[model samples]
Target: MIFKNISKSKLTLAFISIVITFFVWQQGLRDSLNRPSVTFDISQKEQEIAELSLQSIPVNLKKIFIINDPVDQINKSLSDVSFEELTERNKLIRIITSELNDPKIYKNISKDFENKNFKFLIDEIEKKSNNNSYKPSPDTFDLFKGDRFLYHLLSRKFDFDDSALITKSFSSKMFLKILAIRLIPLFTILIGSILALKILWTTIALKKFGWKEIKYLDLELIDMVLLIAGGFVVLGEVVSPLFSISLVELFSRNISNELSQSLKIFFGYLFMAIPPLGIVYYQIKSLNGEFNFKKDYLQFNFLPIKYAIIQGIKGWLTIVPFVLLISLIMNSLIDNQNGSNPLLEIVLNNNNYLSFFLLFLTTTLLAPLFEEIIFRGILLPTLSRNFGVISGIIISAFIFALAHLSLGEMPPLFVLGIGLGITRIASGSLFSSVIMHSLWNGLTFLNLFLLRT
Candidate 1:
């Protein structure tokens, strides 16, 4: 009767945990819907990259890429928009790209910007465009440093001696941007397609392509509820941040906003990890009656490191196409979808080296390690032991996606989680899933880095 009562109590607690987690996840997703999507930012970067490429790309390369005449393209983009609708930056780009023989164009753009320095720069550019001699000032030198291509073009018009030097520098930067923008997608699709076919063939042959049940440390359903709900959601996400943020606020008062924000994220993640990890440790100790790292822990087999790495690579490649397909479908179905993670915008816009490094560490290294340990290493195997392996993989992936609290991103993230779960089971190593997750995030980081001007 006591045993039955204990089981009933555990079941009731598990039910409560599910209800709380669901409510929290729903609120988070709803909140995310109000945030601006990252796709807009990505589009802006693409436009910037394209504009810069047109300025310095070789004529032969432009022909190969089928890039249209940049002046015509810029005119088309600005055609329907009135002067008031155009941003200050867009106005500057338009004025720089235009033939300044039109006096109205010069007056309209220069008069709208109230800043004397901005007006002065516009006036000089107009003079240079019209073959009227204008003395170069320190602001012009700053412009030369800030935007070498714009400076080089203006210098060529004014017949400045340093135009050739600026041209060389501008060309090198444009080459890298163009190469990265064009090659990254092609490389991903090609590798992904090859791996996708291999995965299909392996599935048909019934050979090493599915999630397999593994013998893991004994854990009850209530233990999972305690770890995920009490430890992760309640303590890690909620309670722990209270302390972490307080500490960061105390120490980072004198720092720049960017640096302070970075510290908060870094320390916040560390603190959040502690409670769940502590729970894991405690549960392991309780279950085994003693802690033996090698014998009584999640599987992180690294003996065949090469095989694990290869499997991880293969899993990442195979999943890329599926995830991309889901993202495309979502985009097609939803217009201006919100709920992109705000971290993406921070990474894209951050100029400070120290802050960027901290973010890089959090995303590429720490996130993969901690997330894989929790989801695939522990949660997956425990769930798999209770349910069927396939059910376990799906359920765990769903939970993983929910934990991210992004509605727009959940489908792709869920797909990616499934891939990680499959990799974890098929390779029989938590190390493989960790590698795959790291590679996924590292690729995103690299893309964002390349997009930086």
Candidate 2:
């Protein structure tokens, strides 16, 4: 009874953990996506265009082209019909290829080509240069237009916004805009910091962490045990639902609508199932240890993420972005219970909400723990005892991935499995693998429950 109760308690905790994590995660998403922010970029671009157009001479609008739409003006005056305003515009793309034959025409219209007419400007700019390139775009008002091609002619006088001579190209103002956007990738680096902490804990208990308690997590059995147990759990996870659905269907006297989600879900589970079996077989063949069954039974402390956050990033560590980003996409694919199976349908979908909740718990907590134990803990150890480390890790990782039901989610999961296995091997403890496994699952649940569209 105690053992059964403990098992039930653990499962209950796992389930509750998913629910709580999801709520917090969704709140974070709502805050991030729906926050009201003031941005004046569009208005700024409009103002710049207005200034250029008002000028009697044709002012260069290309400098602001990075953010602003192109103009199809014929001369310095008149806001007549522009080519960009047209709906069916196919000839615009040809300028880069077919239009290359046109001769340099923009001559003595303004500055170097002080041509008063558009044709004259084209004639001058189109003149053959030593570079063997210089084609006049035959289309008038092509400059600074909405088209993807050079909507307008490139002017030497436009002048580089910043270092026109040093970098040879890329205006300073434009460069800054690009730099700002690219900085978003920095989010991943923050994730890397967390991963780094995990590595450290895999080795030493976070001394600078919560109360600095000596928490040495043994990792020796993680990979091999995980390899076997993870595989078996994955099979069970996939198979149980299938059997449930089939049995329900077999009771054809009255078929419930819930069967709809079951069929596709079966595919989802199938996607996960095939991969883990191979991993276990490979591991069993590799390791020759007098099978240590009791030691291989996986166990790990439930990480209070609060503690994980502080201790995980305090040491020499980097947060992993792969799982986070994947979680982001996965979260987008699901919601608290939006994309759930129809068994929830049989229970008027209130059960759906419950099932959805349960699904989160299972995927995030239960799946990760047992799966990691079977694949990384058991199988990997078995393989290493016989074949060696490299082969064991690879085989187990592959099996871990193949065991997933969602085929689309497989590639990323495989990569994650490998990382988990590697960490387990390095730390020589199952705890490290469990942490990684839990982290991956938690992130996915967070994405789904916490951050929804």
Candidate 3:
């Protein structure tokens, strides 16, 4: 360990770095609490899926996927006192409830709306409620052409003659997307619950489920702290972004805004990874002057590639239920919980294929690789050596979650980090944890892609 020979200056530097990281990260977390969440967008897409399935898919399949009247549920979701809020969710709730001639909903439509088409729809709904028989113009359908799903919802209300044709026009492509959206989470959670229960049983009865500690690095706790707090946070996140953003801005002046944003994220991540990883490389080199790259540092252990993949898959499957359960609890407890990563909204709203592809590479590939290396490959093993395996796992996971600077998402992310930590130690392979992190992110990206409809 470097503890015996550690200089006072190095320890002081580590202390200062950790304090700076804490304060800055705390401020970031506080700021994140006020940031808008993507939950509303996700809810809207799920509701659209339910509404579309009702109109397009077979009754049996629809029944299997959608359990209740989606519009009725939307109506129930509306706050009695917050009807005057001009949010997108409020507008949707009013539109859905207007079919039932809700007097309260009509009263709230006095607020001005920027969308002329939506304003016209509200006007038509009002006229219909008053028994005016004021028919919507033929161009009314064309007005909502940009949002085909919303067009379908209003078609039934207006009794459009082409409603049947439109319902029948549901493409096989859309059906598959909807199917994946509905089935993937359901199946993942189901399998995860079973696997989690089995793992619990083994832990309690057989005592065969636990992390096995291994010292992967000959570094002290201060070294680990400095690597993460100083190298990763200060250099990688703060300093690297300054350069990466400038580089991207200088060269991307002629590109589309979406493409520019995507490029910034991709290259920014690559740049950010460089300093911390470089520090790790130098630290390894310093420790073992004539070291073998593969064996002497960060036991990737990919000789048994299939084993790593399977262990990763198992870790992912086992972790889903716990993480999702935390998410569900948080959502129920906090209305409109914020601090959703801005990248989620970007991915959801992005229409350009190139932009989307770049984003996919950033999230599903680069993020997993870099994060696993820092948190699992380096931090976890060192902490385990200092504090024992279980404390090491919890503390590392807490730091991992805190590093995201998203307070609303912290609980679930902490749960996810725990799963990654356990997987790293139990599998005895950093490659397994990387694969697990990649799978977790890849599934989230896939869901977002499917929800774009």
Q: Pick the candidate with the highest TM-score.
A: 3
Give model 2's clash tally: 91
lDDT of 2 by residue, 1-453 (tens): 112223455455445544543454345434434421111112222233332333222246335433333232212111222434311222121121123443432222223322244343344434533134544443433343432123322322121121222222223333343333334345545757676657568557655422221122222343333433443443444344566556545654353343344333433444444545465445444443333444433333234544433332221123356654675675567432122222222222222354455555555555665576566655666555455677766777776665443344455566677677666665545665666666655643442332110
* Each model's lDDT: 0.78, 0.42, 0.81
Query: Which lDDT value does model 3 have at 194?
Result: 96
Worst 10 residues of 2 by lDDT: 86-95
Model 3 score (lDDT) = 0.81
Give the per-residue lDDT of model 3 (tens digit) for 19-89.
88888898999999888788877776776666665656676787776777766665555543365553754
- Candidate 1 lDDT score at position 330: 97
Q: Each model's TM-score, in the order given?
A: 0.82, 0.37, 0.87
Candidate 1 C-alpha lDDT tens digits along 379-443: 99888887878888999999999999999899999999999998999888888898999989988
Candidate 3: residue 238 lDDT (0-100): 82
Where model 2 places Cα greater than 4 Å from the true spot, the runs are 1-188, 193-242, 247-319, 322-352, 405-410, 450-453
